[model samples]
Target: MGRELLRIEHLHKEFEGKTVLDDLSLTLREGEVAVIVGPSGCGKSTLLRCVNALEPVQGGSIFLDGEEIHADPRKLPQLRQKVGMVFQSYELFPHKSILDNITLAPRMVQKRGREDAEAEALALLERVGLADRAKDYPRQLSGGQKQRVAIVRSLIMHPALMLFDEVTAALDPEMVREVLDVLLDLAKQGRTMLIVTHEMQFARAVADRILFLDDGGIVEEGRPLDFFDHPKTERAQRFLNTFTFETVKE
Candidate 1:
């Protein structure tokens, strides 16, 4: 097997007296692209947030590259540096220019020099076809453009595992492709990613493993073709029957 890049064991999380993540366990291998799909309120986003340390888990452990994430508070910054995450909202600093937004984290947390950080950020912008917009403010960009900038902001950190939570959900239909294309290129280049998305076609096209989560834990997991076409659990089958490309896109 490929060396495990992320390991989650018996994860348990609660919110307001309700269990949100219940005894969940999963592993992500280096360079593997794993997509998570489930109905709303199934704790998909919570799982990603927990992994990113935006939320604390009540139980279980998460290890990234064999080092425990919650093991050392002093090391949290270092651990986070290796795990990049982007959410549905493009949380760019409204007052900062695109270049500044991309360079801030690297310059501060990463301790990269200003010139070095800008140089690398510029190249990443070019990769996503946003080089010319470096001086533009967040308000000046399209929804797609803003999301692209958010993505590069994460990539600039050189994260080993990238987490995406329904990134395309807020975009107009025409805009989703640009963001997905960027992710597709990243996957092709072999970045380890864990994504929570309802974009079935994108998941089917890119995911190495597709997991169906329900009631706060994984109900079924398999190859994309098998999971979508031949899901093992009734919950998964019902989920598939409930959502289709048409219903989702609308």
Candidate 2:
């Protein structure tokens, strides 16, 4: 399946006395979209954080594009560049214009020339359907637009993989779909994505496979239809049963 682009082996994490993740292991194919789902505080977010090295892993290894990023400080920048992250809150800089937000990383980290970076940045804005709003500040845009801008900002770096931590969690019901549409498009484009989300329908519609996490480890994983249609574990079944007509995207 195109050489595992990401592999986690015996991963563990602890916060104070709480065990957030325990020997969690999983692998992602180069172009697969793997969705991580579970109840709150189940270590879904912790797992994602550890992969990006945003949080340290006390044990185990995380191989991203064949390099271990678990304990090596030397590979931090390179690993981070390869793994782009989108948080629940759209963390765009308030004062920076949309264009500035998208170009900030490429210009600073990648050191692309101003004109060169801006050219790419503008195209990304267009790609996210925000080309006309390039001059607007974060505060001047709606929640959906801001999130789109945030996605474009990350895409500007041309990351090999993307980590989405409930990217639409803070948005209103109506705003959630817009962001999901963009993410779905990204999936269709064959971007390797590791997403921690509650959007069951979105998962059903776009995910190639689903990983269910509980307590601290991966409880189950399979194709969306197999995982959801007939969940093997009681934990997964109970988890799925909790959703109502509103859908859990938000």
Candidate No. with top lDDT: 1
In terms of TM-score, how similar is model 2 to the real structure?
A: 0.96
Model 2 residue 84 CA deviation in Å = 0.6
Candidate 1 Cα deviation (angstroms), residue 179: 0.6
Tens digit of per-residue lDDT, candidate 1, span 149-198: 99999999999999999999999999999999999999999999999999
What value does the lDDT take at residue 13 in candidate 2? 92
Clashes of 1: 0
Across 1-250, the per-residue lDDT of candidate 2 in tens digits comes to 4668999999989998678899888999888999999999999888888888989778889998789997679879977998889989989999899898989899999999999999998887888788999888999999999999989888888999999999989999999999999999999999999999998999888899999999999999999999999999999999998995566797
Worst 10 residues of 2 by lDDT: 241-250
TM-score of each: 0.96, 0.96
